[model samples]
Target: MALPLSVLLVSLLLLIAVPDIYATFHHGVHHAVGSRAHHRIVLPKHHRPKFKPGPWKQAHATFYEGGPGSFGGACGYDDVVREGYGLDSTAAVSNVLFNNGQACGACYEIKCINSPQFCKRGQQSLFVTATNQCPPNYYQSSDNGGWCNEPREHFDLAEPAFLKIAEYRGGIVPVQYRRVPCKKQGGIRFTITGNPYFNQVAVWNVGGAGDVVSLQVKGNKKLKWTPMKRSWGQKWETNAMLVGESLTFRVRASDGRYSTSWHIAPKNWQFGQTFEGKNFK
Candidate 1:
């Protein structure tokens, strides 16, 4: 049966209107769901700030005679060799500050502030280097409580350095110290030690922003560079003897500075020999 024209037109209009109405409803629902999802997201909180290294710090200092025949210390360098190399009045710092030889070769300036009488007539401060570790368990026999066993920031100074700032009678003194850049006049010095079977190289006379951090060695015949391990103190060592006729060293300081010493050690280099290499500063 054929429907009337008016009824057919009305039916068509209703169909179009129904689709428009459904689209409007869907649009509204989509916006509502999107708004709710946006609200559910959370923002993270800010993190804590990092610590800044200070110029000056307070610490306890004690004087001790390294004594005769006292050579290498916990950092592993011979004290006699260190002194001969012009590192006068070296100090042994606590494990807290030593950082397990990471702080080796670092320099510090100390001033005695607690006792005025112990201070020298005109001397107000003394500068020392970190060459050894003051073990916490090790106690000084002379003093009942050792400086090493003291607080974290304790400094065990050699007798000479201690006397410069304080009198010998004052076994312990409160001091204010600061980390300072080492002032070296000449280029870096390389001290070679160990037996013929092994090669141990100690970097000394380093003058720059920070102490030595990494070392690499290359021989004349070797195509690739070999990284050296930090044996102790400022010393870097390799168990096997260098193969090539000439040896070169690449040194990297803690401050991220690098220096290469080309052929510093000769083929016939003997043990206990010292060589001066290019400067880092």
Candidate 2:
């Protein structure tokens, strides 16, 4: 009654192979389902936040045309250069929002809500970057108590951007604004100016919550990083003589996140030289 050896061997192989086959099939199914679920959970590109959202505020906005004197304001950016940030028809806010240049480079979404003449069709919203400060002296001198003197959250928009939301005759319109992340193209750029002994750097083309609040610099010769003062607008300056061929910078945004750019300045770096570095976005 003994079975054939060949039959016994074949039976054993089937027992082993069946389980292996089932396991392989089950694993494939699980992997496919997991991948599809992950894709579904991802957010859309446009809806993504440029930076973490802050509190919303109601305010008023006025527009002005860019002319000869419209170039530089309290933020210290030279509109004539056109290479620096905020030279375009952007928006300037009062000291309450400017925070003495701390708000420089901050981005906001402003929507025209009131003023029937401007919002007759529907509310129009525009995303603007803060590049300048609305001076308080101008407000004090105006008869109507200019927007600069307003309680807080007042915006002086560039004429072109403002017209997108309101008519030219509207002059001033009620608006609601909220802080949003800045979406920038490519990496951040560092422009070095002044002599090596006293270098001033302007950081621009920042993405992902683009405004810089604090900046620090260090060279190969220095054992520690030196904090740079906000010279004006987006420029940070250090009086220390950077003798090394390369330099590094650590930048902190308004959201309290830090991004470092290492060895951005090359050897033989001269005044008015610009180097592009990694971005936050």
lDDT on C-alpha atoms for all candidate structures = 0.73, 0.75
Best candidate (score: TM-score): 2
Q: Model 1, 1-281: lDDT tens per residue? A: 99999999999999999999999999999989988887665432322222223399988788666552252366656654444433345788888888868787777889888577766667757888777787886646424565565455888887878888888888888889988777766778888888866778988777664478898877777535888888877788887667445778888776666778999888887788888887665
List, residue by residue over 1-281, the lDDT tens digit for candidate 2.
99999999999999999999999999999899989988888845334333676777898888766752364465555552363444343788887888878777777888888577775366456888787787765635333656676455688888777878888888888888898877776677788888857878887767777688888877776536989999888888888887555888888887666778898886567788788877887
Candidate 1 TM-score, true structure as reference: 0.70
| lDDT for residue 140 in candidate 2, whole number 0-100 | 59
Highest lDDT against the true fold, candidate:
2
lDDT of 2 at 193: 87
The list of candidate 2 runs beyond 4 A from truth reads 1-50, 67-72, 79-89, 137-143
What TM-score against the true fold does each predicted structure earn? Answer: 0.70, 0.75
**Predicted structure 1: clash tally:** 1
Count backbone clashes in candidate 2. Answer: 2
- Candidate 2 scores a C-alpha RMSD against the true structure in Å of 7.0
